[model samples]
Target: MNSSQTEWAEAEFSRGWRLILASAFGVGFGSIGFVTYSIGAFVDPLGREFGWTRTEVQGAIAFGVGLGGFLAPIVGYMIDRHGGRKIALWGLVGVAVGYLMASASQGSLGYFYLAYAAVALLGAGSGPVSWTRAVAGHFHGRRGLALALTLSGTGMAAIFVPPYAVFVVENCGWRVGYMALALLPMVALALAVFFFFPDRSSPGGAAPVHARTLTGFTLREAVSSYRFWLLLASILAMYIGITGIVPNLIPALTDKGFTPTVAASIQSGYGISLIIARLGIGWLLDRFWGPGVAAVTLTSPVVACLILMGEPSYATALLASVLVGASAGAELDLLAYFTARYFGMRNYGRIYGLLYMGVALGAGLGPISFAYLSQISGSYTASFQVALALFAFGGMSILFLGRYPRGDFGHEARPA
Candidate 1:
């Protein structure tokens, strides 16, 4: 081929790959951020339908997360060995089927439990570990922002899912809510089959077939490293602080004397902050160490939680909610990006898979966890105080990450 023809063909291939990747990104948007995110909104409906207590309904949510956490290591190992396409595609199948099952659950708690277990299995397949590893394989230079943009599915989900779920469940019934969720995975599956790059990248920049398992470090090697443990600690601290307060935000604010409507509105405001922060964090990640970006984003919650403590008025609650939302919003991106950078994308799935279990674990404990703190004192006020402390500790811990890990994905390491 002539130079011009070769150049044209290369450009065409890049465009096709970009489309594939973007489509995969959308699939991810629906899978991780949308499906999992909308669970909380359905809790009330489940309670009403089954005559279950709030605590009982909360137990189911915890069960799903715990199940997901338990499954993470296996899922990560699968992705690391096989490439993300198959696992993620299969995940979509699970989600679609799970939602369908949940829709049929009606008043049966057993059915609800079974359906959510499927959803949790699906979650293990497509969650942060799977998608982040995909982005990590594709780019090293812009990996942080790349991870952020794809993971922004959560930001989009926070923006879109709740109100939609509320409208469906309030007017139509909870079953319809499940039916609506069923469609999301079809999108994921289509993209996975046609687009997800199912290979570890080649040095020549050509795509290759899914290959046999090549471990980055033996299980022994990983456990011996201090870095791995530190990263794990950071992940746990982050999830506990963010998920703990958020699940209870509406009640916490209402207890502080805000009306339920106002409390709900505060969550919306928080979502807006999170969306804005997500875009800003994505831009920043391209230029800075993810940990540096995390340091700023994580500490944001400390200020907000402290403000929350004052209960100065409803206004403080509103402001605090947004700050917390923004912090929580950007957090998964930080963890994902850091995993890719610190460890290398070669084994990103297995490494991050274990790390993401922290999120699952923290989520499982979010309700009972903070309640214990509240019990230790008197009320939500004291419990939130402990949350704020953890947030601060988590924020400061990012500083210990030292400089960001470096590599040549494509772009220069633009200074933040």
Candidate 2:
């Protein structure tokens, strides 16, 4: 109301955007840029060098992901108690070192698995769980957009990192490709964490002006609640259907008579659509009900699944890619936004970390499940039908979440 109050509020708003910007870069480079999207680029190279089966080479990643799921809750607790700034900074450095070690591998499966596991541990804090806490702590009215912008980094990385990894691999071999992937997180995440990441419990941390009193369930309470279980189950179901299907997208398209190049271009379209969908979903969330937006987004994948399974054509394939991308784009932004709205930010990091573990589990196992199904059935038709059913179920499940908790913004003090 007063001049001083107005000025302080404006300043905090500006600072929040800066935090989003830095976090965007941190996650883009740290999470997907180097790790998720880039990993596929190395699989062939690794196989070629070690004379290993595809499954054997991919096993290291699967092992790391499995362990990362277990690590999420711990990472969340640390962020709640210690803050994301220190965790991200140290974690990025560790990732860089881990990449270097990976580059120096002696073709030993044990060594490769160990190196990847270390990377998973150090890099845990660089994911959405770490930064979402900070962003949620800083913004509310505009929180959806802030998270959308932050998660856009993954879409950006998906568009560029694979090709970049291939370039590095072609010129310098897989060893150097691993090392090159290290630079983004080492330099960007480190600088961003130092300059922009906030510590909400600290005195000087930038917080939104209209900051509300925190009001919602604690971690124990959240786990005990039926709503939480429903939310988790919905997420798991959706991912189980979506994850395994997307990676085989190109192959599915090509088998329908499309050329490999055409299928590849449509796949690239999926990445571009992710960026557009994130921005669109973010804008909608600020104006509409959170759960509604999520439910609709989740349902889009059902149509995509159908299109892919139906008559094969360039137009149908492209349409399916965009729909799948929309579903993928909505996932993290919805997860971060809904978690804050439903549970509050008191223990946001830890709570989200636990939920994210569900995400990690789906991501790790979904593709494998689809592959196994196809292996047994001798065609992907059965797999696609199952995925379609899961998507519908997941979408409808969110409708029961009811109204998001509202009232206060700051964490309410709990009795010990």
Candidate 3:
């Protein structure tokens, strides 16, 4: 980049660093981070307590996240029209309440599912959709890096939440552990977002001097494009593979004869690799072909799937987790970067919301599918095989996107 371009990119962070920090915190504690990552730690505990099958235990995710996916587009439209601040703040509050409701469940599977659904419904705004929109509104030149930094919050959660959840469940019981998890969003995320996130559309909030003019395809135009459908399918497949594997990694490890603590410790490698991958992919996206970068980074997880097919040692298990984390790291960064590059920010929230619906559904379906398959086959081998194919298909699909359109900020082009 030219010196002028470098300075302009630097200035985005100089002025909007608070926005990035707040977004990262919000995302780390939001439904995707706290709920999605921590649910696995609870699976065995919940089953033991309630005498539920693995499928029954994991079914809550399917119900809750599926409902959340259904609501994502609506929430996106609201974010576009109103701004993300209010929605995110309210959503955080609701997420806290939902966790408390879940803690109160007394062995009723229906009640457990309802509580989780409430968490997803009420916490939708606290997810990546709102925060990424806010960040996208402000940063253009450094959009890829900014998004990677923001999304690294999930990596942070991945690093800390599983082991933390396991510790809490071991000492305080699963109910108290759920209650403790509520504190993350209720306190840290809500406070950071309330104080630091500057939504230009909000009352009295100021836009950055370098904020790009809002431009991009409308939701209708985006949906009609072949690229949009391709991206949606790619996201769906990738998440199915990722979510299916990561959440079950701990249980799978324990099944392979590791203790819960050891399993969680090994999973920490996944989180560390995720954080590194996000930053690395972000840097690469700004400098290379975005689709090519995505293809290479996301397709590496086939190795992880293969590694887990055997009773590997702890060191081998850690390697497998790292590979999985690397792929997980690429997902949201690619999603946000592609949406901005291909669709533009004109209808970003709505468009991204629709795409995020794929993530939500895939996340919801992945765990349940893994559990169901494992239950039927008495092993995770079938699930891993399925995920391997998904990783290959999803990773390669991006190559078909061809080149980005010629335009100022991706606003002036549309697919035929």
Candidate 4:
């Protein structure tokens, strides 16, 4: 609140901005960004090529990402034992390999699903679990803003990957599109992360001495807390709602008579709003009640669900997309912020990793479930109705978190 405090926060950014930028790039091109965001662009192509139905095509996500979610706790434990930099670097390489495997998929849908699963399992470290751990370690004063900046990479991926994938799939075929996605993490993100993200646990890595003294609950202690379970339940519901809508958005719009390009453009609106939400909500988290902020931000998407349920104009569709994007944007930010505040950095990687599994599982389920609902009901309306309920439930559930534990640096302890 004081000028000195403000300056200190600013100083944290000055010292750690490279780490933030690296993290952003890693997250954007990593599993959540390239793998998750680009699936929509590939859905129609993959379906047509393999004679797969919508649910079948979307099922790749369920088998791939859902099963991969089981690895989060393991990845988290590794990061806690070692450091994120090495894990992230190797994960990016594995993600590139996964994309190549997807590109090489034959007519076998099982093979395609396995390829995606490989991507999720191999690239697990490249997700928020590793990146946010490093970022959390580096910035305490402006932690919220730092995390927002880091995670806005997903928004960036949302903005670029769909259209890019669509453009590539349209011109060069879907195989080439997957190959193109591979290049992202292989070249640019890998270079950025290797150069900028330092391993604090490694010799000669040059972390602040005080970082070694950071404190928090162990994995067992964190798991025992009621707040941990509450956070997991809320995360699962919120991600299920948003992720179900996102990859399905382009197809749903195209079915409603929008052109593929137009649908992709509308999805861009979602990405733009996501970026806005990350930055704006990040700022708010530092100064406001995080649960209250999450409650309002996540719940606003109910209106988006309502908008999409009816036939709407392009502008309305865009509005709905933006609202959904906004909610998606807030989900990871809240997850990372809440995990650090409630549990502490002692077991941050493992705690956040377990929580990230909820995100991964929800993401995996959302698309397949949405596609299944659409297949049965002949429209996205049923899915939207279900998602609307989920958004409300997830948003409201954050209110039950009560308060942050005392003595967590950078977060004020509220009265119990």
Candidate 5:
């Protein structure tokens, strides 16, 4: 190659870390929101287009959460043991494959469910566990922001994917919408692997020599502990309420007599709120008492539920979206930062993987259970009311976390 070409390639490699960071976000935007939350807006439309039932339509989401739940810890362990880039890249490819499979369902909702769920497992391969691990490895000083920014990709996807999905479905047809979602993951995979991946190393620019997972599980020790369960339950409840209950929101709202457009608009606000809240929370988490801040912020959905139950005021709906969105936005950062502080990092993937199973179970149960509840109760009001109480209890429970360790993290002995 010519000298100029060589220099250009060198410069590109110099910018490799930034590219990797952007790739994390890009893949997130392209994959999760598009494939997961945003799929809701098209739920009703796709059901109509393909002659499917609401239960059948929402089944796809339930399946993905369940799949993610089953797979997350394993994927998390892989992330810690292996690395983030390859797993995430493959995950995106799986997501793309899911989208394509859903598109090819020939109007069968069950086909979408099976396809989307398969993609979801692939997605679990590249989910927050992997991304957060990657970012956590790269920055010690900006760990909070780095984690926040990486996880924020899901919210970014949430922002555009739902409304965008609806638009694609309305204009081009449901098949095209699925295809669009399918195709976008290829871009994420390409950017992630080639231009935007991280090196195996530490923040001081020392190459990361892989750490072994600490062995010997002592359930007796784990059960006796208060904070292990505290952090676990806190993170778990947040995941379920946000991922499981919230994604079904627009559909729930529409079932309550709101127009499809209005539902889509509310969903969009939910998406936008996450993007705004994530950056804001990232800034605040560094300065504020994260748990206190979390306590206050986590109550959004309870407040949102109260707002939602009133006479369908657009303002109230907007507030609900904002609260839910903000909670979802900052949640992973809260858990990751807090976990690293309390438990230490050597077993980060292993510890987090186990913790994430709570998330899986909660998330797995929340949607499917809510769908059945929706059927029995004949409205989302009661189900959301129950979720609201859970959010409130969880929000208030943050005060109890005062006894655990806090402050910025540095190198420490791994938890046994």
Candidate 6:
């Protein structure tokens, strides 16, 4: 093997990857474990126990996740100023407290709302902004793979959390489930951040100049750049498309004649695909043209939408889930990578914070939009068509990014 290729290989598997991967696990529990993955389980129990309507239980999600979108920029700023380690520790504490609040719910809808909003607002630190920043700063030559391994944590959560929560609730009860969710973030995540995670900058100190150069854009420059806006547009479209289909995945499959159990099994492909896409796409980005990889990955969802619009079958449903999950996985990897590539890391926390709003907004809106479409048309065909068009638009826009920034394309060579 060539000397440079060997160096790159060594760096890719270095010990640092383990640390970042561990941090990713902590970040995943903070996000997917307690928040996204666990919420569905909460819905049924909350409904049965308190007689809360589905809409009311779901509204708590909207309140927490939507308002958190507004606070993302603030969290990013804190990450930039305070460093990821500190922010992550604080965020884990907030997550634990939020779930404790959920566990203590006394049948008040207002109290439920408060519980959710508290998590989103205070737990923003444990989100992508904090965890990803540390990984991004540490790895350069193999940044793509490093980030991929880190993000695989969310995929892990998707696979693990749903069944785990079910097992807990089935045996103990919902309050116990909430308490279990809190412990991972409070004890595990806290320990991970303190013992393993490293900060790019010393606590309360300035970032190294080279790190700033690598990040490229300041907060103002990032907001004003056409490329930034383009990326945001793409992010929004992809999220809207994926989330639109995912919420209705079971029903959509059932409509196609699959049994409920089979339909649920097909949905598992999404989580599996998520892990594969992150690693495969990350590997490709390091070798190929970056934007080209994004454009192709994002465009695959259009085919998934088309399949959903066609005749029903087990094979077709599984294919659609895999394709959609691939695109969904690429969303954050590209978002995190491109943000650092285009803008400098000096303000990465804030810029990424603003960009993640797309994630929040689309996830919140996508499901509702799909439901509205199904309600109106009495079928999912119309929603699939709309999503297909948006995915295409979003994919094509990546071409406008032109190329990776100067010095960004495999320029550095460092171990660990």
Tell me each candidate's RMSD, in Å, in order: 5.5, 4.6, 3.3, 3.0, 6.7, 3.9
What is the Cα-based lDDT of residue 326 in candidate 4?
95
Lowest lDDT block of 10, candidate 1: 204-213
lDDT of 5 by residue, 100-177 (tens): 777788776567778868776767666666666555554444456656776677676777667777788878888888
lDDT, candidate 6, 1-416, per-residue tens: 36876686565456475467556766677642336555655655787999985446656655556666667788888777656666666777887888888899999999988998888877777777777777776666677887888887777766666556666876799999888888877665655755655444433222443444443567888899898889889988888787777656655666778754476566667768988999998998778887899999999988898889988477877899889879877888888888877775667778889998887777667765775687678888999999999999988898899866675421233433
TM-score of 2: 0.85
For model 1, how does the per-residue alpha-carbon lDDT over 252-284 read when each residue is reduced to its tens digit? 665677654455566666667776787788778
Instruction: Report the C-alpha lDDT of model 4 over 234-255, residue by residue, as the tens digit.
Output: 9999988988998899999999
Give per-residue lDDT, candidate 5, residue 209. 19
Model 2: per-residue lDDT, tens digit, 99-176?
A: 877898988988987887877776777777777777777765567787888888777766666567667887898999
Per-model TM-score, in order, reads 0.81, 0.85, 0.95, 0.95, 0.85, 0.85
What is the overall TM-score of model 5 with all chains considered together? Answer: 0.85
Q: Name the better of 4 and 6 by lDDT.
A: 4
Model 3, span 261-308: residue lDDT tens: 999998889999999999999999989999999999999999999999
In candidate 3, where is summed lDDT lowest over 10 consecutive residues? 203-212
Alpha-carbon RMSD, candidate 2: 4.6
Off by over 4 Å in 4: 193-195, 198-211, 409-416
**Colliding pairs, model 5:** 19-196, 20-196, 200-208, 201-208
Kindly give the number of clashing pairs for every candidate.
Answer: 0, 8, 0, 0, 4, 8
The C-alpha stretches of model 6 lying farther than 4 A from their native spots are: 1-15, 32-34, 48-55, 170-173, 190-195, 198-215, 248-264, 309-315, 372-382, 408-416
